[model samples]
Target: MAAAPPPPSCCLVALPPHAKDGLVVFGKNSARPRDEVQEVVYFPAADHEPESKVECTYISVDQVPKTHAIVISRPAWLWGAEMGANDQG
Candidate 1:
């Protein structure tokens, strides 16, 4: 028998100062025509006040023959971090 293929890598998105309160994660599956997965995670403020930086990690268990991508968006108050697979994968 053949060994099972390794799981696909995970996708991560970082949020800059401001929009740290709300974080939404979007994922796409191979069979689905559109995004079939949606997740939301809330991170507490660092010191009672609103957080300025936030980072999130998303992993896909539903393996597909096609590539997997993650989309992240937030309010104008927040910004995105400049990271790559090397940061976490």
Candidate 2:
């Protein structure tokens, strides 16, 4: 039988406002199948599809900048993103 995937791990650190050209770095390792790994982009948008606005279902339109950009690491078998970072950071 195949082995189970490893649990997730994450870390976040805040940078000083004066910091320039700073690098936001983190390491992630997953034992999931290679075919399931995928890179995805999450552009902030409104959640108008649902009849009733679900609480915390998505990022609010106002919270996102006009040029906001987000890059995410996702697993194809999962319904949501595993981790991501935004340009503003």
Candidate 3:
């Protein structure tokens, strides 16, 4: 059988404002630890559908702060939708 994907690490940390809501933060990993930033956003549930009102937005790493902590907001929700860690679907 093929190997299963590894469980997510505990290093995930969400930022202050949205942390209490279960948001997670992610950064780049290098040979030595260094700070890198990226942002992936999700719209309201109703907007997820093709004809929904919500507009999906993808903010590239260059748009956000390099050291700023991003809010993953809903990891399980993303996974449930079949969107892997690096996927935004």
lDDT of 1 at 52: 34
TM-score of 1: 0.16
> In model 2, which range of ten residues has the least summed lDDT?
57-66
- Number of the predicted model whose TM-score against the real structure is largest: 2
Q: What is the C-alpha local distance difference test score of each model? A: 0.34, 0.57, 0.36
**The candidate that achieves the highest lDDT relative to the unseen native structure:** 2
Task: Compare candidates 1 and 2 on lDDT and give the better one.
Answer: 2
Per-residue CA lDDT of candidate 3, range 1-89, in tens? Answer: 99988644333446767667655665432232224232345433221333333223432222222222223433332222222243332
Which residue pairs show backbone clashes in model 2? none
Instruction: Quote the positional error of residue 86 for candidate 2 in Å.
Output: 4.2
Error of 1 at 80 (Å): 5.9
Measured on C-alpha atoms, candidate 3 has an lDDT of 0.36
lDDT of 1 at 13: 46
Q: Stretches of candidate 2 above 4 Å error?
A: 1-20, 47-69, 86-88
